[model samples]
Target: MPVVFVARKGLTKLDEKFEADFWAKSLDNVVEVIGNPDCPQAADGLEVGRAYQFQEEQSFSVAKKGDDFAKCMEQLADMVGYHWRMAGADGPGPFRDLFRHPGQFGTIGPVTSAKLAAEFATWDECARAIGKRSFYAWFASMRRMFEYAKTDGGVWLQYE
Candidate 1:
């Protein structure tokens, strides 16, 4: 199965009682918020006010194998002004590890508004990183996600 990065929004009105009840019935299928320690402002967990319900339309499916995926990731890192070599031990570098394990879901972020804004600010850098058609496709996918996050809210990576 391909690992997909998804962004969900527009369902931010669940009260605490509803949230608890929802989780009680669907904990296994519930998605959790993930945090990037490097981003101090990143949400540590799901915030009640900003919570969103998952929707199929929000998915960005990424292939788990082949050169297409690898090259795209390389370009994505570059576009985001993120240098793989400079990534700290706990940074996005772990995303590469997803390829090694197939069919497993790995969650990556409650990527806060600050982080999303920072990434959007680097749009030009990302565009310049697109050296090939394959890279463009990946960049486009990620770009859509980032754009949505700007208004809808934070983002998270669900890899499998």
Candidate 2:
């Protein structure tokens, strides 16, 4: 599955909604941590625009202590719960939509508007980020559908 990048900001209520949605989907092999379980920089929270990577599975965390899943989870929680507090409704173009769908709605590896602004030099980079998300969503949805298509090693076509 392609990496899914989700940004949470400006919507406290929606953060809860995303949590509910993920749990309701009953995804297995995933753990959700609400706060910074491990303090990396001896700071209460990480710098606002930095990106941290971690494993999503328990086994991975156990094998790689340096991976720092806790920090990633904390950042995720902050995005969903607290980032919104600092956001102004009209401060910038995409800040307000952190909780909702920014004009471009897609999911892919951990890229966010803030990240884009910090690293990207031109509009092309931004477009590529959005494209990555769309590609990931399409790839995942199709993979799931294909998995469901084959049952008991037989392709049965049930016609109405």
Candidate 3:
């Protein structure tokens, strides 16, 4: 499926929600972490939450379909691999494997956003990396999305 990426300021509450949603996606009680079982990033008493914030926010834009996906990722496929359906084709990229994670809400924390922005920091640099200029607009938007999120300052990112 195609993905829509959005950025928002970090919120501890939002982190809670993501963790809740992450656990909810798993039909079982067990949840995996990167390494530490007791991931300190998660809040202590967080209730189940939804992507209510992502649906409510109207300030940003959603990039999807051929305009944002196929054509845009055409050149990007070489550096990141063929991702005709999603942002990251495989397990990792300069952007750390886009939306491949379950319950990452089509997006993630500012750290991941930083990883994305780092790849698309500049148009010339991005075009150089992906080898094209026509589809850099989406990358620009993706970069701006992270910049806005950085401006907001958050640990959680809302995705619709």
TM-score of each model, paired residue for residue: 0.55, 0.18, 0.48
In model 1, pairs of residues that clash are 34-110, 79-126
Q: Write the per-residue lDDT of candidate 3 for residues 55-151, one digit (tens) a residue.
A: 1121334345435554555555545554534554344555433434322333344454455567667444746565455456666666676666543
Error in Å for residue 119 of model 3:
2.2
- In the range 21-88, model 2's lDDT, one tens digit per residue, is 56676543332322221212111122322222222211101112223323332332243344533555
lDDT of each: 0.47, 0.28, 0.42
Assess candidate 2 and give its TM-score to the true structure.
0.18
In angstroms, the error of model 2 at 20 is 10
TM-score of 3: 0.48
The stretch of ten residues in a row with the least summed lDDT in candidate 1 is 96-105
Task: State the displacement of the C-alpha of residue 94, model 2, in Å, after optimal TM-score superposition.
Answer: 22
lDDT of 1 by residue, 6-114 (tens): 6655434243443444665653223444433334344433553233454332777755554556666566556545654455544563232222222132233334433
1 or 2, greater by TM-score: 1
Candidate 1 wrongly placed segments (more than 4 Å): 17-31, 36-40, 44-57, 64-70, 77-82, 88-130
What RMSD value applies to candidate 3?
9.0
